[model samples]
Target: MVHIVVLGAGIGGIPMAYEMKDLLGPDDRITVVSNTDHFHFVPSNPWVAVGWRTRDDIMVPLAEPFARKGIAFKSVGCRRVLPQENALDLNDGSRLTYDYLVVATGPELAFDEIEGFAPQSNTISICHVDHAVEAAKRWEEFCRNPGPLIVGAVQGASCFGPAYEFAMIADADLRRRKIRHKVPITFVTSEPYIGHLGLGGVGDTKGLLESAMRERHIKWITNARTDRFEPNAVHATEIGDDGQEKAHHVVESRLTMMLPAFRGIRALQGVEGLVNPRGFVLADKHQRNPTHRNVFGIGVCIAIPPVEKTPVPVGVPKTGYMIETMVTATAHNIRALLDGKEPAEEPTWNALCLADFGDTGVAFVAMPQIPPRNVNWSSHGRWVHLAKVGFERYFLRKVRKGISEPVYERYALKLLGVKRVQEQTRETTNV
Candidate 1:
């Protein structure tokens, strides 16, 4: 029996485990290690921060799902990865050896990079369920004493969807509470334009996003780099089109929620040739560590270079569909390796994200996840909002029932109309 160890149990890790089990036989042993035992549907965290969703609504126990699949689950955090020995050192002073290892620990929130930016400061974050709950409390207090509000992403941050969603939700919440006029809401970002979204503009996204903000009366500061945060205001260095920097407005705000930049898992530090300087594991197209073939990585923890350098610098965004693609590829490759066959290379990931506006939503699908894509499509409508909600409901039910499906394949075929094209080609060639 082969021993396979998977680290972390977030959006990336859990699904990868299921895929691996499906490929490997029942006799193989699989273990999942994670710091937390609960998996939070992170996309809905913005709604939780605005009190639209509760902690319980977004969280699900991992033990039940893993148990249903007959996989071993460990709730201990990984302290170090001894890839040379194919062993993992746990925080509890225990070690486990494996034939194959998967690192899906995801990114860490580097809140300490900014001054006066402690988690319990005047600002808040919705990256986790606990943080969202705490932020919701502060939001409620701010509603009673209306003041300026700021929401945006810091420099080098790739996950921009949450920032947009949070800003819109806050705006909606303020209006519902009859305090929209009193609170001045500002959307600040490192992106050069309103809808760059870390992948540059996605087909008319700039105009559409700007229009949405205008309708909501939300002010914006683009090409801005956050320097520090005080209790009442945030200071940023704003760059102009001429490549000159000037002191921007230090807008006063009663509430602020900024998404900090991401970094690799701390456990991966000092692992020679395995991780890049930024701490993300360096993997080939198949998600296997180039230096250590037995070790693999997926999700935000994997290192992917920036498409191009922006004024503020930006990284690639790893959406749910992208992560699942990596997971699927890794699972198949691992199974092949165990069978003494050469593993197949995984394809590069594309990004598909749906940003929820208060009144509606914006949907985008980018091929190759960066610039120079074949199909970069996006649109905004209330139907997108309803579709997002429906997906969330369907996903939760599937997880509860311990069902595993390739979500990316379904979306890719749907969005690109690939099946329709294939059918048309078949008919034409036959005729």
Candidate 2:
């Protein structure tokens, strides 16, 4: 019997394991390997950081759910991926071999790239649940002593949504506390322009977000290279179009939170032919590794080229919708391999996103995440915030029930004429 091993248990990995299980043979074994036994709803981490959500509200134990589905589960974590041996070396001196391996392990936050950054240092983060808890405490301390606030993503950072969300959420929270007047806010980013979001600004996102930030009285600095974070200052350089540092200054704040660059997890690094220099998996359009035929990749762990070059480094984001499509396509491709057929399915990589600013929010849809797309649109409303909340609840329920794709989710996207995965080959489409 073939054994399919799925690494990581975050958003992409969990759903990937569920979908692949459904497509595999009854006799085939599926094991989910994750560093943590609990699956945390990451999108809610910012809320957690701001006291809106607790650990129990968004986190779910994976053991019970996987056992119910007759799938094996491991949370001890992995030390390294020995692709040559086709085995995963565990952190506890054990190894698990797999006939087919699915690398869904999410990103390893590159906090070390910057000096005096991260929660333990001058800035705070909401990338992980534990980090959010720590950030929550910091948030309380900052609230007690209101002052200047600096919020944005640093260089090489891809996930810009959370940064934007945190800035607004923090703004809303401070306002609710009646301390908005005391806390001046500034957003700094590696993007050449505000709202670029690594997709070169989605459908006038530049204009929409800039307008929103202005309305909120939030100042911004783009093309910023954050050099270091002192006790109450962010030393950064602003690069002009000529590729020279236009200015150097210290942006001071009592509180700071910047999304750092993301790199591949340590385990996947140094695995030639499996991952790129950044430790991100290199997969073809089929989501399968060219050299390692039996291996596939999904989520932030996969390498996606930057939308375009900027004065400072900025990686393109792999949003929730895009990740889900990758998972769907990977599962189908593996099933095809099991059937002794070449992989044919390709994920649409559609970009459907909701950026909530507490009470109000922005939503966007890209039929194909890449440019020259069929559908490209963006709008903002309070309804977007409500929709984001609904999504959190719906997604958590799906994870708890181990549902791969709920009926409502499928029908809803179908109504919008968006697909989870494109079934036809590019050649067929060309014909």
Best by TM-score: 2
Q: Report the Cα lDDT for candidate 2.
A: 0.88
Q: TM per model?
A: 0.94, 0.95
Across 355-423, the per-residue lDDT of candidate 2 in tens digits comes to 889999887777677786666667788977887888888888888898988322463355333343333
Find the number of clashing residue pairs for candidate 2: 0
Q: Model 2, stretches more than 4 Å misplaced? A: 406-431
**After superposition, which runs of candidate 1 have C-alpha atoms over 4 Å from their true positions?**
241-243, 411-431
Residue 125, model 1: Cα distance from true site in angstroms:
0.2
How far is each candidate from the true structure, as Cα RMSD in Å? 2.5, 3.3
Clashing residue pairs for model 2: none
lDDT of 1 by residue, 161-259 (tens): 899889887887788888799989899898888998887877778988899899999999998988899989998888876667965779888888989
| True-structure Cα RMSD, model 2 | 3.3
lDDT of each: 0.84, 0.88
